[model samples]
Target: MKNDERPLIACPQCDLLMREIPLPSKGAACCCRCGATLYRNLPDSLNRSLAFSISSAILFIIVNSFPLLGINLQGNANAVTLLQAVQSLWDQGMHLVSSLTFITAIFVPALEMGLMLYLLVPIRIGLVPPGVSPIMRLLQIIKPWGMVEVFMLGILVSLVKLVQDFRIIPGVALWSFVGLTVMLAAVASSFNPRDIWAHLDKDNDGKID
Candidate 1:
């Protein structure tokens, strides 16, 4: 590519437009003005991220389906699923807390995992799916709202207190929640969104825009 014909890349941090160039394997492009990492060129980023995303989705289903914690108070035994706990909060009239918890704990993470899969799978196979730009925007918008770690901390704290009065039986879903958190972390580290944009420039015939 000629100097002027090379693609333009505006720095995400300082908005300084620079000419794009080929990166070495596992290299990153940095902003000239602010030194922010513009993007990375990681080998097998798509495959690694896809694997973690798939694991996260499975763990997500398991977390919601089974009992998160089994409670036995004074001889009465009860099981509480994730949704059940959220419902209990709602029944207790903590409506705002319940809604926020639901969004952060359940809704946003699910959306993140689903969007990752939708973007990664097609790009892995060398096909660009529809709605790439909007999907990428949505991922960025929801990334910070996924408060799984915070929610997990709250669960652990509550369990510590509950163990004094109730027999806290660790359930499969509890383990799965921990696993989901780990898997999501793995997905985030492995996945690079710029890969999708790189693919977006290519047509089916492998033409670059």
Candidate 2:
């Protein structure tokens, strides 16, 4: 095999081996045998992913800091930020539940967003930082654990149940959380792991330098 030759890739769905083909700008390639999408070369994917990740980070800060819901019961008002909710659960002796909530709702999402920014920002400047491979692998591993959408659904269910007893006031953080969930999903969908690897390889091959 020559150094200039494009490598072959196996179809994810059917395991059919074929030479990788370059996709037109903003186009996708499909597997000939399985008719499954092989890869996509989305135009400006890096910029878009970076934008979404940054937006997610900002929303995450708001979600953790501001009150998610405010309740006025008999003229007494109480509100809870996302972190406070987790702490409240722990204070109520639900240690395991609180830990899970903290991990899924806070830690995983923050880490994922941070990693995306760290990776994408440098790559956009034509630089591949060290540990790109392992970091990317860790990103993939933790992607499903973030669970922002699941947390939102849980909040909605809780709000429905509590509406009968209390005056439910949705806070700014609640809306920010909703936007953060959408941004995170968009970042994940728009980012292609293969694209990053290909770009890194191309850079190393002196193609981009």
Residue-level error in angstroms, candidate 2, position 158: 4.3
lDDT of 2 by residue, 69-124 (tens): 55454666778776776676677676876676677778778888889988998898
User: How big is the positional error of residue 140 in model 2, measured in Å on the Cα after superposition?
Assistant: 1.9
TM-score of each: 0.81, 0.81
Those runs of model 1 whose alpha carbons end farther than 4 Å from true positions after fitting are 71-75, 125-128, 146-168, 205-209
Sequence-dependent TM-score of model 1: 0.81
Going through the candidates in the order shown, the clash numbers are: 0, 0
Best by the lDDT measure = 2
Alpha carbon lDDT at 74, candidate 1: 54
lDDT comparing candidate 1 with the true structure: 0.75
Q: How close to the true structure is residue 203 of candidate 1, measured as C-alpha lDDT? A: 44
Candidate 2, residue 21: CA error in Å? 2.0
39-127: candidate 1 lDDT, tens digit per residue: 88888787898999999999899989997755554567778776776676677676876676677777778878888888888877777
